[model samples]
Target: MQKGKIGVSSDNLFPIIKKFLYSDHDIFLREIVSNAVDATQKLKTLAARGETAVSVENAKVSVSFDAEAKTITVSDNGIGMTAEEVEKYINQIAFSGANEFLDKYKDDANAIIGHFGLGFYSSFMVSHEVEVVTKSYKEGSTAVRWTCDGSPEYTLEEAERAGNGTDIIMHVNEESEEFLDKARLGEILNKYCKFLPIPVVFGKKTEWKEGKEVETEEDNQLNDVAPAWTKKPVDLKDEDYSSFYRQLYPMGEDPLFNIHLNVDYPFELTGILYFPKLKNTIEVQKNKIQLYCNQVFVTDSVEGIVPDFLTLLHGVIDSPDIPLNVSRSYLQSDSNVKKISSHITKKVADRLSQLFKENREEFEKKWDDLKIFIEYGMLSEEKFEEKAKSFFLFKTTDGKYFTLEEYEKLIADSQTDKDNNLIYLYTSNEEEQFTFIQEAKNKGYDVLVMDDVLSTHLINKFEQQYNNKRFVRIDSDVVNNLIRKEDESEHLTVAEREELSPVFQSVCPADNGVNYVVDFKSMGENGQPMVITRNEFMRRMKDMSKLQGGGGMNFYGDLPESLNLVVNTDHPLVKKVLAEKEAALSADLETVNAALAMLKAEQESLEKAKEGKKEEEVAAADNEKLEELQKNISNLEGEKRGKLEAFGKDNKLAKQMVDLALLANGLLKGADLDKFVRRSVELIN
Candidate 1:
């Protein structure tokens, strides 16, 4: 027997590997199994080159657990290390400038492990003692055994003869006794070796015997050896891709569609990306895209590797060129990753465009299920935004669909405003906003249905993307103003508006944190007596603030809602109210107006005299007189308004009109709505 220490510049190497080399010690199984695969692959390469004399037909790797002995072994029938090769590869740790390297990278041990070729040593992380019994394939070569107990020192000695191969036997440590469990070992093997190019066996297949699962004689292979992504796209059928998706996500719903990526020129990347039925919540479905390196499972948290929006997609991405840190625990940013991300974004856009071009009716049929993903991608990725325009769709309230260009053309002539800007009318709820939608349709305009959770952000993005284009909700304004074609003619003179303003104000609801403004517009006599509209800018800000939940926008979300009470001057009911008010308050309003005119003329004369003068130059006596006159005029006006308010209170028509408008807008609730119902009954009677 010959024994020596592992050639390392530091005595603390083993401790570091056990404690910090990998973020999670569970990765030790992946590292060991990967090494075994590498050995198997290399032997196959040499045998194919006619450089090896041994038969290569029955090559395989196997993992087994011994509960009684508290040991787990990974064996491979492939090229094994000779004693001399072990001395060079296993004994000598490849890290140069050991002290400085450790000092500089101790905090980044997980990343440094792959860089310094410490894969084999990771076995010590979960085992108190590890033994490597290897027999080289070289003719006349004797078998050798290497044993170490989580230390720098090791023993090398001659062992019993065996077929050419290697066996890694680990005596599970007390802290890591979980590795000794048969089910645990099977789980680790399945996770890391599920798609390996070579078959990996772990115990025998099981069958239901009596009432419990019993082992069968057939070997239970854990990996597919040739997953779907490894094959060419032309060779795969639609069902093949779908079957692979089901294999990856057993419990996921049927995908809406998929994008098969197989690129070779810029960077080697192959994967099947499935568009799952994403929940309205963006967070609950993220990190479902599993990333792989040469069929070895790296991670599912592929946020940086793919575009942020693509994280909502679920599937497997297997690429040998993706850069992985030491333990493959996470992704490292590099040019290849960026190129891959851009490629994926392009592929996704291309697939959607193709589907749309092939059969638009089918695309529109699936739009509801696929809306959030496409919108998110367009909103977040600029390159994707440019590509998405080709296939993006807008569904009208009437259940018709149009592309961006097509929709713009369909509404360009009529929806264009006096300012030459095109307006897109949209409704959040087809049922709740049915009245508003019908009104818009009555004006020869189409209203779109934008009810997705991300619609607020998406429309905001579209406004920036297109020139002279605006998205207006159906209920945001009166039908005439929604897409104004020309300047509106005055329906009521200043004197007539002043006489009626206070009457509506008195009957309008009190401050419920909602600011109400009374306005008059001439729709024909057939228009509704009253309707409510909201300012577009303020409403959008509030909606976006609720979605973003941050910054000064949140202040907008907390502010009171403001609505406009639009009374139709042409409606017979509103006209009747105005005529009644004129008859009741005409005498009182006439006297107040005469006195108010005299006080206003005097105040104007005084203000004209002081127009260009500084405050000191204006006489204090004149200022005082002007203030007294203004106060008297204001009091007289207040008295006039009081008379009008009293008249409005007594007139149930005014209150009923306001309630009708509120009800149209879905704002009148509870007692107020009940009052409207009772008043309507009495007025009809």
Candidate 2:
């Protein structure tokens, strides 16, 4: 036996390795298994180069535990370290100065272990002592044993071995007794080694025998040596991708579609990304994409690797170029990482565009499930937005789909207003807004079903992208005003507007967080007597606030909804209400208006005389007379409006018209709805 201290500069290295070398002590198994894989791969390379006589068959890494002995062993059938090589690699921890190392890696344990040549030392994290018995693959090379007891001092000696391989034996410390549990170690192996290029055997495969699981003679291989990502895309079938998806997410729903990513130009990247049938909430489905380094699982939080939107996709992304062992902050600044991100976004956009072009029917069929992801990508990645425009679709309320370009052309002639703005009409709920959608369609206009959770944000993006184009919800405005080509001349004069405004306002629901303004429009006397509508800009901002969680726009969301009580003046029912209102309050309003008009004329004449002169240049008596005339005019107008308001309250037809409008818009509810129903019955009778 030969004894010597490790060549590390400090005696503090052992303690640092134990407490700060890995983020999780359980990762010790991953590091050890990874080393074993590296050895096996090297042996294969050497054999391929005619450097060794070893056969490549039955090459595997085996993990087994002896609970009674309180030890765990990971053995590999591959090129093993010779005594001299062990002394050089294991003794000399070739790393930075002690203080520099601690300062750099004190916060990130995995950085220290993965970046430094300390994969084997990580064994000390969960072990009291570690032993390495290795036999070199070179001919006539004798096997050697290395032992260390969590200290700088280690012993090397000659040992008897049957074949060229390596075995690491770990004496589990009392604090890490969990590592001795077979199930616990098996889980760790499954997480880290499930996709490694080597077959990892954990223990004997179990089968149900006599109603209880029992170990069978077959070995339980915990990993697949060649995952689908390592194979050529031409050799894969749809079902093959599906099977791989199931392997990655055992309990997840089957994906809607798969994009086999294989790129090898600027940087090498290979993996399968699947479009999941996501839930309504994006946050719930985020961080599903697993990142891998050479098939070794690194993390599921792949935000830095994939674009922010693509994180919703679930599957594996294996990139050897991505730094496997580094802090997340380091990854954010990696140029290769940024390139990979851009490449992935491009690939996803290309796949979607291809799918749309090849089989638009199929793409449209899956659109409901795929829309959220595409919208998210378009909103997040600028390049993706530019590419996605060709494939992203807008589904009409009539169950037809069209690309934005196609839809714009289809509606440009009919939906463009006099102001040259193209109106893209949409509805959130087809059933609730059925009347409004039908009205839009009745006017030879197409309405889109913009019902996705991201639709509000997405349409905002679209309006910015397409000049003079705006998206308006179907219920946001009256059908005529939604895409007005030429305004219809007002069929009602000012006197008519004054008489009907109070009649409609009186019946409008108060304290409902809605502001209703009465307006008159001509609709060929065939349109509905009344229609309730909201302003597009305010409604959109409020809807966006709800979707995006306010974000300082809560004022719009919290303010009462402003609605338009559009009373069609051409309708016969409204004409009857106008006539009745005029008859009921005509005498009172005329008398008040005569006095108000005379006072207003006197007040106007006095103000016109003082227009260009200073206050002192004008007569003080004239100013006093103007003020008295203004007060008298205000009093008479108040009396005139009060009579109209009284007539509005007593008129049930006016209230019925207002309630019908509210009911059509699905806004009348509770006591108002109940009253409308009862009044509707009485009016019918």
Candidate 3:
């Protein structure tokens, strides 16, 4: 026997391993099983080169628990270490510079283990003592044993003969006796080593024997040695890819389609990416891409490796290039990750393009379910945005699908505005915006169904991508104004327009934060008395702000909602209103307007001299003179508005007109809606 001290520079290493080396003590099993896998893979490489004579086939890794000995051992048949290799690898604790490295990587230990080669020391986390009994594959080799007891000193000695492999025996600590439990060890093995190259045998298979469960003689292989991702693209059928998906996610629904990535150029990458039926855009999740190094699962949190948008996809991404230690902090740079991202994006777009070309009707049928993904791709990834427009689809309110070019051709002559801008009218809620859709349809215009969460951002992106083109919500304005063929002259004068606004404003429901704008449009004198529409720009901005991580829900959201209330002077309701006003208060409005005009001139005259004046000099003259004019104007306008509001409150025509508009837009709710319906019956009667 040979006894010597550990060759680590720091004596506090074992204590560090016990306390801080691994965040979770349970990961010690992963380190052990991974080391066994490495040794096995190296043996295969050696056998392929004809360097060793021992039979390499049927080599397996076994994790067994012995309750009597209170030890769990990882045994492998591979190129085991000789006495010298054991002394070098086991004696020298190749720890990362903890004092400096730990501070930099306090948040994540990804680089720590991979950079410092601390795979072996992870055993110390759960073991009170660890022993490595190994024999080299070289001919006529003697077996050796190296032992350490959570300390700097260790013993190396000649041991009893064993096969050409390593046996790592960990004496389970009192605090961590969970490792000695067969069920617990099996779980860790299944989690970390389910797809390792070599067969991992934990225990005998079980079966029902004479109406009781019993262990079978057959050895259970706990891994699929060749996962589907490891297979060549031409070698696999569609069924094979799908079966593998079920293997990875046992209960998930069948995928829509998949992309087989086999890239060896710029950087080594291989994997299968699946497009799942992601119904809700808000429910789209990240880390669905399971990243693997060789056949071993590295992590599922592949946020940095794939683009933020592509994380919505589900499948396996096997790449030797992706480096992750025990703690998985993604460390790839923007370039390598960008390459992977661009590659995946291109592959997905190409696959969709291929599918569309192969079967047009089938593609169209799936567009409703797949639209959100394509739209998100177009909006979030610029490269995809450029490539996707050709294959991207637009589904009209009538349920017909069209590509950008196809849709443009379909609506080019009819929906084009006066400036020749292609106006794409769309409705969020087809049922709620039924009036707007009917009006659009009546004018021989097509309205698209843009109702998804991604639609708000996507239309904005589309407008930017297609210059001289704009997307307008179907209910954003009155039908005539929405397409805006040519601006029709308003029948009412400016003074008459201002006069009617206060009347409708009084009857409109103020809660739900609604505010109104009164505008005049000549609707051939027969249109509805009032029509309400949302401001498209602000509405879209608010929608997009929610999608792109609503920073403060209060900011843009707190402002009172705006609606356009259009009045047709030729309509009977407004005509009746005008006659009533002429009989009641037109003379009063003229008097108030004249007084306000005089007061505004006096106020403007007073503030003009104070433009460049100092504060004291400005205050020296007529500050109150300007204030008096403002107060007097405010009083006159208030009086005029009050009289109009009182008239609007008393007038059934005004309330019915605004309520009819609100009902058309589906904005009137609860008691107000019922009252509107009740009032409609009374008006008819």
**What value does the lDDT take at residue 434 in candidate 2?**
91
Top model number, TM-score: 1
lDDT of model 3 at residue 538? 83
Give the local distance difference test score of model 3: 0.80
- Residue-pair clashes per candidate: 1, 0, 0
TM per candidate: 0.91, 0.90, 0.87
Error of 2 at 396 (Å): 1.7
Q: Enumerate residue pairs that collide in model 1.
A: 114-326
Best by lDDT: 1
Flag regions of model 3 displaced more than 4 Å: 16-25, 67-69, 94-117, 210-212, 324-330, 334-338, 552-554, 584-637
Off by over 4 Å in 1: 95-116, 279-283
Candidate 2 wrongly placed segments (more than 4 Å): 14-21, 94-116, 140-142, 279-283, 326-332, 493-496, 616-632
lDDT of each: 0.84, 0.82, 0.80
Each prediction's Cα RMSD? Answer: 4.9, 4.9, 5.9
**Tens-place lDDT digits, model 1, residues 1-685:** 9889999888898998888878877889888887777667666666776778887788888999888898989999877878886787688875322223346445432111133467778899989999999988888878899999978899999886578888999998899998888888888887777988768999899999899999999999989988999889889999998899888988878999888889888787989999887665465665589888878888888998898889989998987678876677878899999999989998999999899999988999998878888889888999988888888889898788999989999998889999999999999888888888888888899989898789988888878877899999988877888888889999889977777888998888885678888899998788888888888899889988988885878888988898888889999999899889889888888988998899889989998998999999989998998889889988988898898889988999999989888887778888888888999999999
How many residue pairs clash in model 1?
1
Whose TM-score is higher: candidate 1's or candidate 2's? Answer: 1
Tens digits of lDDT, candidate 3, 1-685? 9988988778887788778766566778877777787677667666766667888887888888898899988899977988988876667666433223346434432212233457778888888899999998999899999999978888999997558999999998888887788788777777767877788988889999899989989887789988888889999999999998898788889988899999988887889999888784656465577877766666677777887778888998877566554343344565776777788888888889899999989888888778888887777788887888878888888889889899989989998998889899999999998878988898899999989888887777778778989999987887888877885665777777778878877887877777787777766565667777789988987776676566764466656678888777668778898789778997887788888888888888778877888878777448878877777888888899899999999998889888888888778899999998898899899
